[model samples]
Target: MAVDLENPSNYLTTRVRQAVNWGRKYSLWPLPFGVACCAIEFMSTVSSYNDISRFGAELVRFSPRQSDLMIIAGTISYKQAPILKTIYAQMAEPRWVIAMGACASSGGFYNNYSTLQGADRVIPVDMYVAGCPPTPENLLYALTQIQERVEREGLVPAAVRHAGRVQV
Candidate 1:
């Protein structure tokens, strides 16, 4: 097949799509909202060991206002649940939440009392990373999942939860 470089119709849509895809492929900054123990693992994932920079997520924002992803790490106490909810709400649209650690995902051993049953009770979690305190490798895996989710959904904010039960 001969290439038609001069024709306006030739590969115009393809070129536009490629450019859009390339821009979206890069530039994903995850906001680490680590409250406790799992924070250590979160740090390692971005640090020298796991090296999250390779995936273009090296810039982990501490402020929810500037972040597109919120990583809820460690236990969400009753006292902290409101704060977490507020923070997640503050993040820009097209944001994602990763519930890291058993404590964050299911409240771990603190199920009986003050801790929240799960971070999901407070925010819409996109991914659940299991562990009393998930390892750096697990955190990276969770990050990869978040990236895949972003690519699949595009830039618009999709609410996975509406009024409690999962939105279908």
Candidate 2:
């Protein structure tokens, strides 16, 4: 049903599903997997100037078990892929990943035997922020997109999410 903005009662009639979605969308906890230059921008995104807290993601958790969002902001070498997978596995259900920057998204210029072609090769990615080192605004925008996805899809079981990466 459509809500009538002119009527105050419409606000009170909000659906529980929408309310739950709103709560989950705003209260996202992120795991910062910063490994290179893009990590600098990731740090700046959380600084007072950028204020990632405004979106309720101010509390950055280093533990994978505590965070639902993982921001992979740098290159992922083959040696590190297993570690990243382990971290992703440790995270609670309904986890999400953001490949922040060209390096994290496609191994950037380090397309050699050491670096993985992309984070997707190791773990499932929910979003990809393009650029050598994306700006804070870009990261924020990616967060917003994640929020939107959560709002639309709501929370689902880990088995149902299907990131497509089989954990060996």
How many clashing residue pairs appear in each of the predictions shown? 0, 0
Q: Look at candidate 1 and tell me the lDDT of residue 56.
A: 85
User: What is the C-alpha RMSD, rounded to one decimal, of candidate 2?
Assistant: 3.5
Best candidate, lDDT:
2
Each candidate's lDDT (Cα)?
0.79, 0.90
- Candidate 2 pairs with clashing backbones: none
Per-residue lDDT of 1-168 in model 1, one digit per residue for the tens?
A: 989889987664446545664566567778888889999888888888789888888888988898887888888999998788788778887777789999999898886779899888767787899887988888888888877655655665746433355432
Stretches > 4 Å off in candidate 2: 1-11, 163-168
| Pairs of colliding residues, candidate 1 | none
TM-score of every candidate: 0.83, 0.90
Task: Rate residue 67 of model 2 by lDDT.
Answer: 96
User: Which lDDT value does model 1 have at 36?
Assistant: 91
Who wins the TM-score comparison?
A: 2
> TM-score of predicted model 1?
0.83
Report lDDT (Cα) of residue 8, candidate 1: 80
